[model samples]
Target: MRLSFTTISIFLSLIRAPGVVSQTGLAPKQFLNLPLGEVKPAGWLHDQLMVQTNGLAGHEHDFYDYVAETDWTGGSSYYSNLEEAGSYWFNGMVPNGVLANDATIQSQTQYFLDYVLDHQDSTGWLGPEVNTTKPRYLWGRYPFFFGAIQMVEANSSLAGRVVPALHTFVKLANTMLHNNGEGLEDWTNTRWEDFVMTLQWCLYDFYPDGNEELLLDTMQLLKSYGDPWEEVFKEEYFPKTAVENLTNPFPFLTWHGVNMAEGLKALPATYRFTHNQSDLDAASLGWDLLFQYHGRPSGIFAADEYLAGLEAARGTELCLVVETMFSGSYLYQVIGDPKFADRVERVAYNALPATLTGDMWSRQYLQQQNQIAAKNMNPDPFPTDGSYSNVFGLEPNYPCCTVNHPQGYPKFISNAFVTSPDKTSLVHVYLGPFSTQTTLADGNQVTVTVDTLYPFSDTLTTTIEAAGAFTYRVRIPSWVANGTISVNGAQAEAVSPSNGLHSVSVAAGTTTIVLNLPAEITLEPRPHGSVAVHRGPLHYAFDIARTQKVLAQNAQEARAVDLEFDATVPWQYALDTSSLRFQYSPPASGVLPSPVYDSGLPPMSISATACQIDWSVAGDTFASPPPTSPECTGPTTNITLWPFGATKLRIGEFPTVNLTA
Candidate 1:
């Protein structure tokens, strides 16, 4: 059922299908997403993706039982009690395989896609659940198709087969929705937005032929049955304190951290269909409240399982980190807000990498901002998580993060650059080393190349080549106070950005525009009178030397082992903020290290004067919140801090020291 690439492209162009704006009068998207592989990673980003390919992300399907022997591939049952792990792996692996263009990964992806498509039942139900009286959970299909559709977009040859199969499933989904959402319950009901998002993609992009009304109806019905995220986001319903501390029986679904992350864009996604202002307002309010109450220094909200509090010791789940990145990217594309892009970069650059090892083999189920050690915690801070939750392992406390973490950077690369609705312009939403090629509305072939260390280095060089002139927009992060842009190395001019984006009239042919955004060291005040170090997008953390012990080894890969880390030196430090200095040492060979996140390889660090403080561990496991105006217990000495993502053991939030005290 596969169609040739030429046929699919022609078919897409001829369709008057509701793209950004559907025939049902949906609101137009501010920015449109490019296909999966259109934006390619380069430089440090490329190295990072390669490292992911050589690590768990690329090999999960080969050895991981959840993915390797899952029911999605004709096995009897999923490894985990929840049947979504295979889908998670697929959702992540599709982009990684397509973006990396790795043969082995691509083959694995094709094999799974072939099996799933071929196994579709006559009832139009996808997956291995069939003919049992047991309640069917359609939630797994949401992530599965999320990856499937990307594969279709990346490799258009899958369009004929995948599109029709998707259309069939939509028909069944619409039927089920009409019957009061038979299978939509619990988690599925709370997370209906994921299904709605997929439906919108089909209605707008694929032209579900005569099923437009059906798709629209299904979206409305799903919203009616789904969690009232819009209503819950209101000030009264939104929990200001930690879920555990609240006396009222708060809707756990609303407070569940991963759900909050995925639900952040739920109303915004609904706004596209309803075009209601309240939906948009509610969406924005939810974003603010989530962070205001539960936000961490690493640009993620505390949700070790449910919404934790603002305390630095509270753990944030790895699933929440990647989901927040996705939701932020979605909000930026739909709402066209620069702040959303900034948040996405913050999570990607700091929290995402901080959760995983440098090799991407091992990962923490939960990461703490003031983490001093990566070991099983007996009296852990997380209200809903277990002891192994904070340890670095293959499956630590839960398998969800293990299967789900792969999508973080791969999807980040996919959404790095987006096109304007009319296709007359391209916007660099999230700055990184990537390039994009797309045809503009005027029938001009445009290629944009961005080369820079970005987030680590302040300079970004963008080379634009087009058959004709077009508008080029680069996002000016909220952090940058004075950014400069030069045309072809000409005299630099101050960049006056509107709504956090600076636009330039790019002429035809190759033109190099170098942008310099100088950032000054700043301090973010935290709870308990502690402060976090920040310069540009990277968060600075005190690099604590740690000794790692392999608790267990993976049967498939010896290198992929469960790790327990203990700080070798003291991690209790109070910084003298006045003495902080930013340092940059470019690579001697002018090449970034293979694993950019490896400690000391980032080539950028901060030197500051600090002294060991009397900070003690909570329950002798996690570091307690920084003491309020604590006296220094040791002599002051110069200390070095690395990027938060570079250090596995670190103190991201430090107490301020008063030398005269």
Candidate 2:
């Protein structure tokens, strides 16, 4: 049923839903100051990408010991293992904006490189690894080999062949092929994801390997996964109501997660050679649907171990958040869609921060939008009533989310800027002096230096050396007021680039632009039901520990129960808007477990003046709850009523309050 007017007003007034749109395009390459560690947070996020790589790094042996080694099964792919690996792999790369650097960052980086060296069969397919029993490496094996190619591309000095990774991949691929008529595994063109796999394979397939057998098999495979990634990721077989199981079954959805980035495989070749529309569309939909059905306010899916129906509370793993971001960036670059980029930023900033505590000491194995408490962490975390509101500390169940969560921030810093096709400067994110001597779009050795304190303040200045009428695009968040762009300090209107990007011209000399962001607050209701408050991209919660609750005057006991909202401290989040205060409190004297008051419920509702806002939402009924589950608790007992978003056992739709004589 649709929301009534009162509920709609509350929902429309408080809720914050991110528009389904993209952010800006490329930032000035130099703007991403990677050396001085100004972007340390983002790099930390990147460190997570090769989480398996770093897992390998944590060990003396690359293949043997992985970070989540005991728990993570990257090889057991397209299954639970695939869900784990795909989730983590997605995080390890994207959120952190992984640079294709050497082994310093990831341990599995070498594993992939070595897998290529060791597994190269007589034929061409590098087949990242062998299923000896099966024909292909489980999960997206092509991306596995492709992962090595990315690392090698970052470092040219590590040489052998430009396509050494491909050489190894080809050998293994050939071993599984039809050797004259006795097809090795009897695989006489048993068609699978050859096109998607070979999209990355073909990048090096064209590189000249003496082995013709391996080459032909790859060509056959390349034609398989043509360009469905963009379309397929967004395309759903059924809607929420259409599906029988509201939650996805274990085995079936795992396949969807691994092959999630099928379309993005075409980017390297398309960027290097062809402008394929199919490639772009495939990449777009691949990322779109993930956010659509599974996205949380935290910028991740409701997947503890796998993708859940959208808005389902007990979902979203740190591993998945990181990997989704990694894939999101790949899609963004390939499709050049700004919306994907925007998703990257929002999730990186808000959701990513809460995943790992500010100190980096604690992490949740699984993060949830309705999460109010941290529970036991293990292979997967189980959420209960208590787990909703308590923000105590690091959980015990699945500690991988803890160890792996730290990378979300550092990786975000790394992802802030990407290499432009021409490889010039950087894309400006957050704002800071970014310095790097990378190759720009013009093939010239372009060195860029940018400096700004962004988000905290809004004036960015950049210095470019590979002179010409070089154009740089700076993203102005929709939150900001539109203003004129100033070159070398003169005001001029800058052209809007992709979705959220602004284009500005720069000369050899320093060009300064005053990017303006206006401080304005807006609201939109949730797609499902209920209302949530937000300022900008930030969600608001009633910080109970910080505020006062209304109490009875005859309260002699310190554990006073009869409480209500406080009028003294207005809802700062509302700005000029005001909320009516309840003059009484819940009859329990203080917060308690299983807060069922007003009827046979434990929390007997009584209206009164509030002691503080933080202690409780200082207001009356937005809309009355239908009725509480019948329970009999003794009278004069204590019960806790946490703000809806703050505590797991919160009562947003409270029982009706009546005045006490």
Candidate 3:
């Protein structure tokens, strides 16, 4: 008999490991990310995702040809697009959100799921086998494994098939490794090998019966071939040298920004399987080094194919943004680290939005932190990126970002709330509007509704409906200096979030927890003595007026209409740092409107007195922030700055002048 999704969810809730499997390698009792649709995104987050579904992710076939396949799984077409389409189907656009019950989404997503589950070979290969005539091009298999993770997370009915299939595939792959050292080839040396480790750990977590032997054997196999990152990082980054002077011995791993970002989770995953403190240290050190030299104001590392230095004009690939986000999501689940969640939020709030059009119709292949133009140029700011790298259009330079970008928003929303290992507590990781239903370890079911305009307004309220009492934990960001929590109406004096999390006993029958998170504005020093402004999690940038020019249909792909944005107003401004102040316009009293862009009618603005500096342009693009302590050239003027994502073209990192001095 066919059962409802809610019924299936309840059944899965009761289905525990016979003893305690570490096949997934994650300690389920510590933290559990709910199924994809269990926690639904609402408010502006919901609206943004809806726009994406209607814009490109929903109608992907209308614009691109490769991902339009229902049966074709050949390697000739980029498989990342299909994987991306699957993620979009499961997470954001298709089966959930505004189009939750849409028949087209239901059929398309179900067919894709069926394709993998029904077409598995007797040998247990999941997706289409590329190069059947020759040895499997091992590297290509990794993405399907990566993509399968979303399926297993979203569809409970498929777990029985997916889990066993994963077991068969990993064991087969392991055997192939033994026969001729299959995966130990050149491409496997890159961090992509980490997926094997992750997949094994997932299997280990799935089977309570214990597959420890197979797990360790696979780990050892990958370790022999994968990048010897811990040793290389410790030697190259020892004494933790400054970023600008740091040179990577393995240019293959370090120079490729997306690879570097994707590799960040490898050590963290290693720590999960081995519980090695050194692995954890390596993960921590890796983060320290990335932000030191190649970091952008948007909480991403600079890479326009290579690790460009910290000049804001240098570009960051959109692929790296989504990949790093995916890495952080996994890292947080395995280690229960709050810092990983914080990194996720910084990228989500700043970089994700800045790179996409407000309507989600277009995106940049590479976006600059101090961008003043988004047009094609003779010499792109990115040394390796193509001419159309900065164009706000569909599939500007490559199709990778277009296919990969959909996972960021939906995954962020899915991870907003998670259950503790024992299922007696709920943890609200990121600030967003969403609701989730989960069964506690004690067999009581609970529902949580998060209500707020978080990352915009500081106030957040969560209402709990449950059959019994449970511990409700709220993540208090380190950036929040004055955070307070109240239950029902009385202040929860016993709850101190000094350790980044606050837990309080939430009784059944509509218990409400109100959080007051106060933010403070501060100037973050940037490269070459410039500074990017920040208030709590949001980055502030000069709101520049943009005049979009539709580029002449010059590319071979005539269907791909590109756009160029020109900043009409003067962008060479140096802030009078002392005159900065913020004036907030709170959300309207009842039923918040469609999408609020950080403010209302008068427009919530951060005003400061500033003067035009001698900052010039590099070709048509805004030049790098004038070297340390720029000298003013024009009289002081009042200027407004808004959240970095609100403006199409912005000066995010700016030079500063001591006007009084």
Top-scoring candidate (lDDT)? 1
Against the true structure, candidate 2 has what lDDT? 0.38
Give the residue spans of candidate 3 off by over 4 A.
Answer: 1-30, 70-103, 130-135, 183-187, 197-202, 207-212, 238-247, 491-495, 552-560, 589-603
After superposition, the stretches of candidate 2 with alpha carbons farther than 4 Å from their true spots are: 1-147, 174-202, 205-238, 241-251, 254-279, 282-290, 310-312, 377-415, 418-433, 441-443, 456-459, 492-498, 527-529, 534-661
Q: Rank the candidates by lDDT, best first.
A: 1, 3, 2
Best by TM-score: 1
- Tens digit of lDDT per residue, candidate 3, span 451-540? 877777777888899899888888888788667788888854434774578888888778988888877888888877788888878888
Whole-model lDDT, candidate 1?
Answer: 0.84
Residue 194 miss distance in model 3 (angstroms): 4.9
- Cα error, residue 26 of model 3, in Å, equals 7.2
Q: Write the per-residue lDDT of candidate 2 for residues 1-661, one digit (tens) a residue.
A: 2234575445433321223221221111112223212233212223233342332212212222222333233444332222223323433432223443434445544543454455445554433342335434322343343344444444445446536655564555444433431222211121124223343333433344554434544443332222222223335532232122443221133323223322234332232222345545555554555556655554555554434555424545555565556555555555556676666665654455444432233334455553322332222223221222222233334433433443444445554555554545455543333454544556544455655323222345565565444666665555455444556657556435557677665666445555544333333333333333333333333322322233232222222122222223222121111222212233343322221211122221212122211212212211121122212222222232222222221222212222221
Worst 10 residues of 2 by lDDT: 609-618
Give the deviation of candidate 1 from the true structure as CA RMSD. Answer: 7.8
Against the reference, the lDDT scores of all candidates come to 0.84, 0.38, 0.69
> In order, what is each prediction's RMSD in angstroms?
7.8, 14.4, 8.9
